[model samples]
Target: MKITVDLDPKLVWQIQSEAARRDLTPGAVLRERLVSSRNTLELENRIRSRVMSGMCDADIAADLRLVVGTIAAVRRRLGLRPNRRKPGWAA
Candidate 1:
């Protein structure tokens, strides 16, 4: 879903600068901001609880009828690491 668009050089520089300052890629920063603006508190809460309970973003996204990136965006906003292990699987 990536589209090429012309952006002012100054805006691009600002985005890159903010990204570096936050230790994130420019795309991550943009996605985080977009998701934060669009997602509801209840939806965010659901994602948070499921993520904390060890659900992977794909599974949460599937169950919630949302994109995996959206789940990831919400998870990042919650400051949680990506879930690597599947739920209920012994290590």
Candidate 2:
């Protein structure tokens, strides 16, 4: 459910600056920080495990119908770990 929000001008500027620094759009950064920054949920955990299991973020997000940034945020919270097969590409 997408909602329209009226953010303070300063906050918007800060978000834009952070997005530029992170090489992402403002919306992507906001989603990562606000939505995905919440405690890891069931779906998020499953996505993290799949990511840790060597599935790419693009693939996982596509399969789960979620944004890549959300997947990335969840992955960050889960910390880096070796996949079951321990592929170098996963590192």
- The models' CA-based lDDT, in order, is 0.84, 0.75
- Candidate 1: worst 10 consecutive residues by lDDT? 82-91
Give the TM-score of each candidate: 0.51, 0.42
RMSD of each: 11.4, 9.8
Error of 2 at 10 (Å): 29
Clashes of 1: 0
Clashing pairs in 2: none
- Give the top-scoring candidate (lDDT): 1
Model 1 misplacement above 4 A: 1-39, 85-91
Q: Which parts of model 2 are misplaced by more than 4 Å?
A: 1-40, 81-91
Instruction: List clash counts for every candidate, in order.
Output: 0, 0
Q: Candidate 2 lDDT, tens digit per residue, 1-91?
A: 8889999999899999999998999999888878655745777778867876688776677778889788777777678543343344331
Instruction: lDDT for model 2, please.
Output: 0.75
